[model samples]
Target: MSDTTSPARLVVLISGNGTNLQALLDACQDVSLAAQVVAVVSNRRDAYGLVRAQQAGVPTAYHPLKPYTDSGRTREDYDEDLAAIVSGFQPDLIVCAGWMQVLTPVFISRFADRLINLHPALPGLFPGTHAIERAFTAFQQGEIESSGAMVHFVVPAVDAGPVLDQIVVPILPHDQLDDFEERMHVHERILLVRAVQKWLTERASLPAV
Candidate 1:
């Protein structure tokens, strides 16, 4: 935990559009929040989130897999290098928002308890990609009445981490996928910002590491 005089630093990772990242950036402006994003990292060079981070004056780094793979770097090696870049920031927390890669265990173990990820489904419902679509399909098939979003610790297993927070959104029978998706995105953004603030507050109450 950090002293009240110093804000907890954050390193955010993103793979695509960063609506969630933007939310955190906005939340940090409150001045009362106990955290600030120190850097943003992306695996894709063309990710628009880099632009968003730049606009917010946050330093950004790109670690695309193609270059490393082209040079015959193993997945574990790529993750290790990425971990080093993140460590250089010395962040108290690392957040993965829309980051698409299946990170190696090396990276997950490096951050451990301090790493968190945002997933577009309730815990244990959908674990991998296209969670929103899967939920919609289930709803259409009458398998569920609602779907949700969750934020959880990043563990060795994909999307199989200890859940920190979640919020449900009902799938009305008449709801269209596009509208439902937009609603989920909105809920995700709110939940992510609130969850990060709460997590930092809880950590701040603990004894220093």
Candidate 2:
């Protein structure tokens, strides 16, 4: 276990361009943020996040998502490799910034409460890929009240863990998926920074940040 009173050390996992990774880097520049990103991990070698992480002086690595999925490899095989890579850093928090793989039980059990993620929709709403499109469709059908982002503990079930924090964005009449997603993402960046800072600056009461 990490020394709760000490600073938080994070390992960010990403699959895509890692805009959020940039946000985290920005937050760390603040003296009071109380956390450090020691490593940025990606499932794709060519992910832009890798470049950003490297430029930001964070160690980086790639593990293709396919090798860990339902591609004939045993869960333990994938979990062993995953565990070695992640555990090597001794991360206090594993931020699934945009990590695209669904972690296996072995990985989840080891990390369990230590892992956190940001999802694109308010919980109990859009829960998968193309969340913006899903929310737009639902809003068009007059069903969705709102949509936004949330930070939650990573569990076996995707985006179905206890929420650490969240910000709700209304489904506006003029909202396009692209525009809405962009705006909501801005909120996501600020909100996540706040959450991490709160956890770090305050006493060692881990309250889901």
Q: Please give the lDDT score at residue 40 for candidate 1.
A: 99
What tens digits encode model 1's per-residue C-alpha lDDT throughout 1-209?
34655888989999999889999998887764667889999998999999999999999999989978898989999999999999999988999999999988989999889999999999999899999999999999989999999999998788999998999988887799998999999999999987898887778677765
Candidate 2 regions with alpha-carbon error over 4 angstroms: 67-71, 201-203, 206-209
Which parts of model 1 have CA positions greater than 4 angstroms off?
Answer: 1-4
Against the hidden reference, what TM-scores do the models get? 0.96, 0.90
**Tens digit per residue, CA lDDT, model 2, 126-203:** 786777788878888998867888888888788898888888887778988777778888888877877666545543
What C-alpha lDDT values do all the predictions have? 0.91, 0.81
RMSD to the native, candidate 2?
2.9
Each prediction's RMSD to truth:
1.3, 2.9
